[model samples]
Each structure stands twice: as C-alpha cells, then as structure tokens.
Target: MGLTAGVLAIDAGNSKTDVAVVAPDGTVLATARGEGFRPPAVGLDTAMAALAATVARALAAAGAPAVAHVSACLANADLPVEEQQLTEALETRGTTVEVRNDTFAVLRAGVTEPRGVAVVCGAGINCVGMHPDGRTARFPALGRISGDWGGGWALAEEALWYAARAQDGRGAPTALARALPAHFGLPDMPALIEALHLRRVPSSRRHELTPVLFATAADGDPVARAIVDRQADEVVTMATVALTRLGLLDERTPVLLGGSVLAAGHPRLVDRVRALLADRAPRAVPRIVTAAPVLGAALLGLDRLAAPPESHHRLRAHFGT
Candidate 1:
C-alpha cells in the first residue's frame, strides 16, 4: 500500500457533476463541481473536457502530483457498453478508471454494510441492488418508455399534462392550471402553452412546477393528487423490484431511498410509498440516507486500490460517518 496514494472520485448526475480528491486516510484534499455529463445536456466530448477540467482543479488544490486511481459513478451508465465508453473517456486523462452506474455509489454511501437495495429518483429514476454473494439486478429505467414513470421529469410532465387537460375541460379541474402559469408569470393556460411553443420556457426549467403539483395535491386537487399517488406507487414498485431481485423481500431487509424527490421530505409521498412498500414487501423497511454520493465514489476508489485494512478503516472513519 502506498502511504502517499491519492484517489480521484467523480459523481456525474443528471443535473451536475461533483469531483473530489482524497488521501489514503480519507481526508478530502479538494473538490470541484461541474455541469451534467448525461447526453443532450452535455455531449461526450464536452463531458470529457469538463471532467478533465474539474479533476485538474481538484488535483491542484490538493497539491497532488497525480492520482493513482479514479472511480466514476455516473447516471445513464447502467449498460456495460456505456460504462466502457465512460471509462475510456476518463482514462484518456492518464489514470486507471473504473465506472459504474450512479445508483451503486449511492447504495455504497447509504448502506452501512455492502448488501441492500437503493432507489434513486432524480431527473430520472432507477433501482439497483447488490447481494453479498455477488448477485446483482437493476430495474430498467426506460424513461417514459415501457410505461415507466417517476422522477423530476415524470412529475413535471404529469403536471403539464394535467394542466393542459384541465384547460380543455377533459380532466378533473385542478389548481395546477392556475398555479403553473403563475410560476411563469403567465396569466392563463393559453399563454403558458404559447410560451412553451415559442421555446420561451425551457424543458428543464419546467421541473420547477413539480412542487406545485404536490402543493395542489395537498389542497385537494383531484388531478394533482392522482399524479402524486401514481408517482409514489411507481417509486414503491421500483424499490420492490430491487428488493425482490436481491432476495431481500423475505424479512429484515433494509432498503434506502435517495434522490431529489425522496429527499424533498414530502410527507404525503413518503407516507404513500411507505404504505405501498409495506403492503407489497412486508419485511422491508425503508431508511433515509443523508450521506452524500461523493463519499460513495471515494469508497469505490479506495476499494479499487485494495488498500490495507487500517487504511480502509481510516478512510471509512473519516468519510463514511
């Protein structure tokens, strides 16, 4: 084991990328944040360039001559081919790199031990689990296809669809029609539609209306409540699939929830998901994870080094808790 060894960890999410450099002892030497690496938001060339820039900045701040290893946990990296592409891109910067889906990193960061299920609902939704004996399964996150639903994008789309329906009197009346336009300072639904058509309103920014959906549901809007309830059910379904695949559905299995939607602390959504999970998987209990994803990426980097026992202990003590 090299006492002076350093690791570079990168967590590339849908909305942002976070990079960190850490010593063998787990003390973070430096950190940097950059734009999203997912396609459409950032092309392969731009994403690699941004990764290099962030890594260079962190290394300079850490005063490290070079990093010995890199572990990147990225969104949209579920397939082996995607992982290979991302790993190749990072290796061009001159370090041995390992790549895995972002949810694995979240699971590592949130789970005290190594075996359990993790459900992430950020801009997109995914569920993943790893067993103690190396078995693994990941639920497909087909993004609006395969009847998949959940995540910020799902919520936003639901809200907009409801608002448009309510405007046309084809759906149950809801406050979303009023509230959504107010979000953009538009006086009515027609103007909101016009703004969307004119490209005055960006698709990503439409996610901001998700909160209004929850609020409308709270205030007894039938359409909004239906959307929220359906989303909660979808999340529970994803979590259940992961638990089942891991054989953790029997009893005493722990499931951790992470991502923007779950972390938002929406009581109704939380309660609905808890109810659904309990009904479907009687033995599973969902836990809250407050650990940052960067820590998970760092743990993966350390694991790759096959660091000494004492080094692992020190790293976890410094960053895991």
Candidate 2:
C-alpha cells in the first residue's frame, strides 16, 4: 500500500457521487464518480460498499492507500447524529474522517471562507449555514414532513396537481394542463394522468415536467407563475432563516445558491430570490455556486489540516473556481 499526505474528498449527492484525491499541496491527483449515496433507501453496508468502491478507485489512481483525512459531503446526512454516524462509518485505520450535509459543499465551494449560508434545490430543497467558529445552522429537509416545499420533484408534482385540478374543474384554469401533456406527447391532462398512474410513462419521467411548468409560467400562466414564485420564496425563506440564525443577516454575508434548479438561473425565479433577499436580508451577498462540490470537500479537509492560504488558492484554481 502506498502512503501520501493528502485527502480523500467526496461529494455524495442523492443522484451521484464524486470522489477526489488531493495532495497536501492542493493538487488534485485523481477523481472518480459513481452511484448516488442513499443509506436510507439501501442499507448502510450496501451504500458504504458503493461509495468505498469509488473512493478506492480514486485512491488507486492517486497512488495512495489512503490519505490523512476523509472529508465527505453526503446527501441525507441531515442531522449531526447522521453526520457522526457517517464519519464513523467512513473511518479508516490511519485516517480521520468528517461528514457534513451536501449543502455545506455548495456553501464552501462558493465562499472563500468557511462562513456562508447555502440553499440547494435539486431533487429536494435543503439549506445550511456555517460560521468560522464552527457554529452551524441547518434544517431537517425531510420533505413535507420536515416543512420543506421546493425541489424539481416537488415542483413537478405540484404542476401535476394544478393541471389535474384545472382539467377536472376543481381549480382555476392554467396552461399547465395543456403544456404538461404536450411535453409528454399526450393529448391532455387526463391522458397524462392515466399514463403516469399506469406507469406507461415512468414516474421518474415526471422531473421533465418541471421545465414544462417553467415554460408555461413564462407564457403568462398565473398558476404556473405562482408555483415558480412560491419556490423562489421558499429558497429565500430558508436562506434568510439560516442567515438570521448565524447572525449573518445583519452583516454582509454570502448566500450561495446551488443545485440543478437554482443553477439553471430561471430569470423570474432568480429575480424574485434576489429581490426578496434584498428586502429581508439587505446585506446578504447572493451568488450561484457553479464549482464542483468535491472542491469543497477537499477544502474542508484542508481546513482541518490548517493548510496555508496558498494551498486553498491552488485548490480553487484546480477546480477552476
């Protein structure tokens, strides 16, 4: 087994996993991608096997048996206990390990420092905040039961609800009834509903409707627009709450936006988020985090190591941030 003073950095989201081996000098020696991390869906051992396989590939490519640290930003590690459990699960003989919510990866990937609030809207929505002093604020992010409301899947489901209701005379009229069905090459909402219910159209295909909803809204459909607006509201609401908890709302703090939905930068939603943030958290500096989140995992490891400023700069450069 080879030895190296480096970090095995991982960003494991609900959809996919990314691993990187970074040397102490901040050069990324290797990287690997694999299946998503979902311990709650698959058992813990199964999930670990998938992630460990990816990590092993990266380590082998980097010519290291292991590094001094394993920094994992994982999806579904919502609570501190979950993070601690994952840290212990990932621990190796010669390495220290830490695990944090995936949103924190988006946060650190955008910020120059360890302090910021980040709102991520992908398959689901989540928020997280951190201070340089190690204080953190986060949410349960356990879907509706956890009081969460925005995400691609949720948006698609909402659009379906509104469209179904509009078709059945149970709700106000909206173009979603037409646009949504048309997107799937169906004649109308009833046909779309039948197909979805019977699995003629895979349920996973529902995510495609999110963009259709946005397009309908852009065409001046009030119902669709309201849904989009509500999503923007949720994003800002979460960000504002996080910032306030971290005492950053009163200061000029960075609020990072990440994930597929936010990264798309839909003009209406983006504009609304900016306007709301301006009003509710006037000093909050909002920006989109487009960098690969594995950089943030690596940065967190370097932060633990007390690596120099130049190392951080070099790492950012490697990730093109």
Candidate 3:
C-alpha cells in the first residue's frame, strides 16, 4: 500500500467510467474513459472487464507497469459492505485498493479538505460527509425504502400525482395540470396519464417532466411550488443531519450542492435551500460543485500517498478546479 509505484484513480459511474494514472509528484501521466460500470446489471465479472480495459488503457498510455494503490469512487457502492466487496474484487489486480461511494467523489471534489457534506440529486438522491479525522457519514440511499425523497425522478412522480389529483377534483388546483402534459405535447392531464399508463409515452421519458414542474413552480403554482420547496427542505435536512453527526454544525464548514437538480440552481429550490441552511446551520458555507468527480478520486489517491501540498495543488490545477 506504499506509493512506490504511484496511484491509479478510478471514477466509475452507471453510464461512464474515467480512470487516471498519477505519478508520485501529482503529475497526471495518463487517463482513459470507457463504458459504464454497472455490476448489478452486468454482473461483477462483466463490470470488472470493462473497468480493466479502461485501466489498462490508462496504464499503457502512462507507460506504467503497475500501480501501488488504486483509489476508486464507484456508483452503487452504497454501503460499507459494498465498498468492501468492491475492494476485494479490485485487489485481484495485485494492487491495494480502497473503494468508496461515489458521493465521496462529489464531496471531496468540492472541499480542500475531506471535511464537508455533499448532497447529490440527479435521477436519485444521496448524501455523504467526511470529518477531517477520517470519520464519515452516509445513508443507505435506497429510495423510499431508505426514507429518501426529492430526486428528479421522484419529483416528476410527485408532480404527476398532484396534477392528476387536481384535474380529478381531488386536490387543489395547480399549473402543473397544464404544464406536465404540455411538456409531452398532450392536451390534458387525463390524456397524459393514459399515455403513461399505456406506455405510449414510455416510462424512460418520465424524467422530462421535472423541469416542467420547476417551471410551473416558478409561475407561482401553489402545488408545484410546495413540491419544489419540499425538495429544498429535504436537501437541507440531510445536510444538517450530516453536519450534526460529524460535530460540524457549530463550526464553519463547506456544504456542497451537486448533481443536476441542485446544480441547475433553480431560484425557488436553491434560494430556499440557502435560506433554510442559514437558519438551521448558520455556520455552513453552501455552494455548488462543478469539478469532475474523477479529480476527487485522484486527489484521494494522492492523499493516501501522502503527497505534498504541491502535489495537491498541481492535481487541482490540472483538473482546472
């Protein structure tokens, strides 16, 4: 686990994979991108094969015979047991490897030190926090089963529910009734609902309604606005809990907002999130993170290597952070 041969960093997501070879001096010698790494879908052997191809390409480009350590930030490594399983799988390559949930990548990418909370909300939602002492906080993030809510997919579903109810006289009126179907070129909520129910609209395209929901909220629709506000509240609630768990609530700490939903910076959601955090965790400095997660993986590898500040600086500069 020494840094004799330098570090290999991997950022593996559901749709894409990025890998890098970094010298001891923090010089990025080579990098590679490949297909998605989804062990659950393709099985461990298939996923590892895809990852190995990308790693081999990176190592070849770097002219490296081997790496001493592998730092992997992987999607689906939700629990500690999952990280351990991945670590054992990667160790077969004859390198010491450490696996962490991909949320850690977003968290580390946003902070100079591994001492911040990061909440990511793309198709799904997740949160992770790390204390400077190496303690970490995370959740199962298993959708509703894990008591999570307010991701893009969930928001879309919620919007449809309200719109349907309003159209059927079972709930309060909202512009979402018009906006949701309009997004799909439908005449009304009933038609939209029928299309979706019959698969004429395809379940895969449901995420397209999220922005329509946001737009409806921006137009002062009470139901849509409530949903948007609830999302913001959920984000802050998770951040507050993480900060409290790490004993960072009273201290000034970074709160990183990432993934598509937060990164979009919708005024209603983003502004409400800021306002709530200011009230609940006044010391937290909240901001959006745009750095590539792979950079965080590389920086983590360098951390394990105990590389100098110059190394960290060079790595960040190279990644244009």
Best prediction by lDDT: 2
Q: Give the TM-score of candidate 1.
A: 0.91
lDDT of 1: 0.80
Error of 3 at 117 (Å): 1.1
Ranked by TM-score from best down, the candidates are 2, 3, 1
How does model 2 fare in lDDT? 0.92
Candidates in order: C-alpha RMSD to true structure: 2.5, 1.0, 2.4
Alpha carbon deviation, residue 156, candidate 2 (Å): 0.4
Candidate 2 is scored at a TM of 0.98
Q: lDDT tens string, model 3, 1-321?
A: 223348888999776899988887888999999998888889988998889999989888888868878999998888888889899988855367899988888888889888999999877889999998999989998789889998899999999999999999999988888889988899999999999999999998999999999988898888999999999999999999999999999999999998889999899999999999999999999999988888889888888888898999998888997
> What residue runs in model 2 are displaced by over 4 Å at the alpha carbon?
none
> Per-candidate TM vs. native?
0.91, 0.98, 0.94
Worst 10 residues of 2 by lDDT: 86-95
Order of quality (lDDT): 2, 3, 1
User: Model 1 clash tally?
Assistant: 0
The local distance difference test score of each candidate is 0.80, 0.92, 0.89
